[model samples]
Target: MNIYFVRHGSTEGNETDQFQLPTIELSERGLKQAEVLANRFKSIPIDIIFSSPMMRASQTAQAISLVTGHAVNENPIFEEVNRPTAVRGRCKSEPEVKEIMKIVKSTFTDPDNRHSDEEDYFQIRDRAQKMLEFLSKKEERNILVVTHGEILKMVLALVIFGDKITPELFYEVKRTFVPDNTGITTIQYDLSFELHESGWYVLGWNDHAHFGEF
Candidate 1:
């Protein structure tokens, strides 16, 4: 089974230094980005398309669906990781911003110790595993999912090193491979071995060649 993960297009939140709103739609640049993304997947044998319920991701999925002829389906498993209520709608330079970011980052490598208000790292991993299981069991082997940047990183960490990724290594990998808007990450799962074994490997990461001369 092969899964193509697309980070959602740029949102209004991406363009400004404001607090994240409850629902952010795509910016004009994001719409064009989505068009470019659609063109890249038009020739692929994409059997199904799934996206986070978030407006940005759904809009991007719609653009791809227009060209790929695949219906867009909403799946919560691919939704962005839930953040603490206190973190929302806050300015970027708030003093608590650093602490909030620290808390979110810790969730990537430390599955056991999370603040009460935020989600545990295990929850993110569980969702990623569930999304994988759901897609892998389907008859359609070629799949596309549009999701958020941070959660994609979490999913990749879990898929690559599972729950044992150290905090240091997590930063190293993320610093080197964070996905850009509409960036694509591909994973190939080999059926010959158990999932716990070396059965799956990333075919590519943060691929955005489609955004040429833009």
Candidate 2:
């Protein structure tokens, strides 16, 4: 089976540097990025389409669906990790949803203050593993997933390379596999289940040839 992992188009949060900004919508450039991706995959026969529940990913998936004619399945499990203060840390008072958004934005911008009360790395890994396990059992020949950057890196690295990912490794992966707005990563999966053989094998990463310059 072949699966395509795509990062959503650029959002206001991306322009301003935010982590898991749920309310942030796609920018004009972002919409164009989505269109470009849609055009790129217009010919490929995508069997199933899946996206994070967040608007950014959902919108991207919808745009792709316009061209591919595939129905999108919204999956909350694919949503970006929750970084709300109440969820992550011991807070004196519960932050308002907007306040939580601010905190998440701050966390991404200021890495020095990141992980103060962040979600456990293992939790993130386990959730991603569950998704992979579900997909492995599926009969779909071609699947597409639209999700966040960090989660994609962690999941793809674990599934493809069998590497023990560290913070440093995440940084390296981000640098090496920089997915532009609406960038696509393609991976081939083995039919038979085996340790090294059954997991993902990356065929292409950060493919934005569909989009013209800038």
Which number leads on TM-score?
A: 1
Distance from true location, Cα of 73 in model 2, Å: 0.2
| Per-model TM-score on C-alpha atoms | 0.85, 0.78
lDDT of 2: 0.75
Q: For candidate 1, which ten residues in a row score worst on lDDT?
A: 108-117
* Number of backbone clashes in candidate 2: 0
Q: Output the lDDT of residue 98, model 2.
A: 50
Candidate 2 regions with alpha-carbon error over 4 angstroms: 86-117, 163-171, 191-195
Question: Candidate 2: worst 10 consecutive residues by lDDT?
Answer: 85-94
True-structure RMSD, every candidate: 2.9, 6.2
lDDT for model 1 comes to: 0.79
Please provide, for model 1 over 106-165, each residue's C-alpha lDDT reduced to its tens digit, 9 standing for 90 to 100.
Answer: 665565666545666567667767777777777778989999876788668766885576
